[model samples]
Structures are given as structure tokens and as C-alpha cells.
Target: MQIDLAMLFLTELQVGSERLYKIKRKGTSLNLRYEIDGEIHRRSYLSGLSWRAILLFALTEGKAVTVHEMDQPGRYRKLFPNTLLRRLHWYARPNANFPPVARFYDPNGKAVMLLTRSRVCGHAVDALHNLAHSGPVFQPLWISDIMALRPMLGLDLVRDETFSAAMPISAYLEAAAMMGRIVEEPEFPGLSLTGNPRRLVTPPSSKAGRSIFDQASRENPALEKLRDRTIYADYSLTI
Candidate 1:
């Protein structure tokens, strides 16, 4: 289904009261545009990495971001590997289950599971499949779970935030600059909040790219374990 996941439209008086930058999802692709001195520039991305891109962009603008959902469904156990990348959904309320439940999207973009409160609060696992195959039933997980596993997944959780008003021009451009680095990093497969476990071949290191992970490394020691593992015949981590 088509959704307006998030949009950032920056406007400032110094910029002639015009929108300096704008970003949002249409159908499945991301649409980006920016104007400077009345010259508008536009671009689009077909990557499902839309959610993460929006988060980075928002953070760059110093704007708060958040997860939003439209309607409830019959089940929250089935995994929608690509859902989290499509939209930011903090909690899932299955059918009429009074309490809204936390969820986990596939780091490799394969599934989304409804986590039980127990699973949500448990210590993070070593790999995606470890958590996915925890039990017969698919348990949901909280954002904390996702954050804990950020290292294993190659994700940066710093950009996630509650929604805010449109950004100012200066901030929008600064955010755009950060987005450029993320987009240009050859080793990074588009910024995925769930991480990119499928990254079997670690591209040559880029100092700029590694800088992004520096913050994460300082925050958690688990990230220093840069060893790789094979799961279901697929490489789960970059060496």
C-alpha cells in the first residue's frame, strides 16, 4: 500500500521564504528535492531504504522523527521483511489485543515479527536468525531490541525521533550533506535501520564511512566484535 511515511520541507526567510529542501515517499520510492536561489533540484530513489534515509535526513535537519501506522490487522506475527524500511512503525496492535506490542523488522529485509513483552525486554541475540527462530511463535521486539542489535545489523539508531515541524534552510542543507556521505559510501548498502546482514562482501574501508560507526563503537563494546558468521548459507556480518 502507498503511504506518506515522512516529509521534510525546509523554509527560511533568508532563503526567500521558499522551500529549501523536501523529502518523502510516494508509492515505494523516495522523492527528494531542494531549491537554492530559486533553482530547484530533484531526485528519487527506488530503494526500500526510504525509512532510514528519512531518519538520517531528519536528524541532519535537527528535527525529531517518529513511527506512525494507519490501521490494525488480523495478525502481527508474520514477518514483513521490507515493512520497517518502508515505514516507521513503533508498535503493532494485533486485532484487538489491548496493549500495543513492539515489533522487529528483518535486518536483512525478510520479515517483521510481533514480539512478546518478554522478548522485547530480553538481552539481544548474536544474529538475526537467532532471534527470528527463538520459538515456534514469532515474538515481537521493542525499539530497544533493535538498537541493541544495531552493530550486528550495520544500523545507526541515533537518527530515529518523534516528528517535528518543517526544518529551516540552513539545517536542511546540513542534513543533505550528511545524506550525501551515507549515499556515497560504497561499503554501506543504503542506510537500513534494521542493518544489512546480507552484506557478504565488505567493500574496502572508507575513512568517512567508518566515522559514522565511530559513535556506535563508543556507545557499545559489542560492536568491536567485527567477526563474520554464516547463517543459512548467507553471510550475516561484514568482516
Candidate 2:
């Protein structure tokens, strides 16, 4: 039996990160603890960015690693061709169904499409409207659908939203690139980098990258701006 070393590592890492969040959120500066191979490990501190870095590291080092989660048990998720899945997976959580989702099924009657949550983009509404008016039944699961399942899977946090909608594929890629994360080849669109994710965390420098942040910033001016009169990345949780 060939063991999946990467998945094993991620499982432990995820547990530890969650523990770290609980400890720090309480204003306690305690080290995170977890067990692996009968050995205990501890970390003085682990920031959210650091947790994401560890995930990226695992992805890059273990290319064949099947990214698994709680929502879709026993299903290995992929990141490419639509990195937006990562965004919805990592950020979107349970909330009041603002901008309610539209539900539909494929012509075969076997597949169903349920529009759930979306990022800041408004295209999800347009897509749902078009699909409802059009005549193609939904299928078992689209790549985006699979990605949307992230939050529901085994996440310890109480979440109200489920990602039933698909965001623009290009937007994910652009966001990933801006974040300095590796862009998987055209065939697979995911974030995988061998080096530190911090290296790629700089502000968007390209024309297209700048455009994305600019639009997002404008749409969420209140949250994107800082009290010091400076603005941060539109999608950044904190500056």
C-alpha cells in the first residue's frame, strides 16, 4: 500500500492550525500541539498566512497529493483550471443567504446545480439567471462545485454558507498570481510553490492584477481601506 505522505502531513497540519487559532483568539500565546507518528509537535505561533503557506508547501512538494477536506468525505479535490475554488473553499463561510442561490438540474435529471455563495463578483447571479432561462440540465458536479464543497467538509467552524456558484476562472488565477503563489499550468489551475508564499505576497504589480484589486477595492471601499488613510488588498482579511 503506497501511503500518501502529503495528505497525512496536511491532516496533522490542519488540526494544529485550528488549535492555534483557538489559542490565539483567546489572547493566549500558547504553543499549538498535535501528534504525528506517535510524536508530539508544538509551535509557538502560527498565523493564518502561515497556515496557508504550509498548505502551499505541501501542494508543491507533494504534487500528487489529493487535497481532501471534511465537506466531501473521501473525495480528493483539485485546484487547477479554476483556482477560484481555493478562494471559495478557504474564505466563504456560513452566513445568511444574502443574494440567494438559484437551483437547477441537468437535462438527464441525474445532475443538479445549486447556486450557493460567491465571492465579490456579480457574475454568479448573471450565470444563474442565464442557466435558468436556458435548456441544459445540471450534471453530477462541476469542478467549481467540488471546490465549493470545501467549507462544508469537516470544517470545525460553524459556517452557514455553501459555495453552490462558480466564480470566473481567470479571476482566481489573477488573484493567485497577485498573492505570489505559483500558478499551475493551464491544464491544472492551482496554487503550488516550492519557495515561501511570503515572497509572492507583495501587492499586485501587473496591469491586469492591479485592475482586479482596483475593482474589488472600489466595490468594498469600507473594508479595503485602513484608518491610516492607506488601503490594503481587497481580499485581504487584515492589513
Model 2, range 86-119, lDDT digits (tens) per residue? 4434433432222223333333322223333333
The segments of candidate 1 whose C-alpha lies over 4 angstroms from its true place after superposition are 1-44, 48-50, 66-112, 116-211, 215-239
Candidate 2: regions farther than 4 A off:
1-45, 63-157, 160-239
Highest-scoring model, TM-score: 1
What RMSD, rounded to one decimal, does every model reach? 20.3, 19.0
Consecutive 10-residue window with the lowest summed lDDT within model 2: 1-10
Residue 78 of model 2 has an lDDT of 23
Residues 85-145, model 1: lDDT tens digits? 3332332212211121223444454333322222111211111112222211211222322
Q: How accurate is candidate 2 locally (lDDT)?
A: 0.28
Query: What is the TM-score (0 to 1) of candidate 2?
Result: 0.20
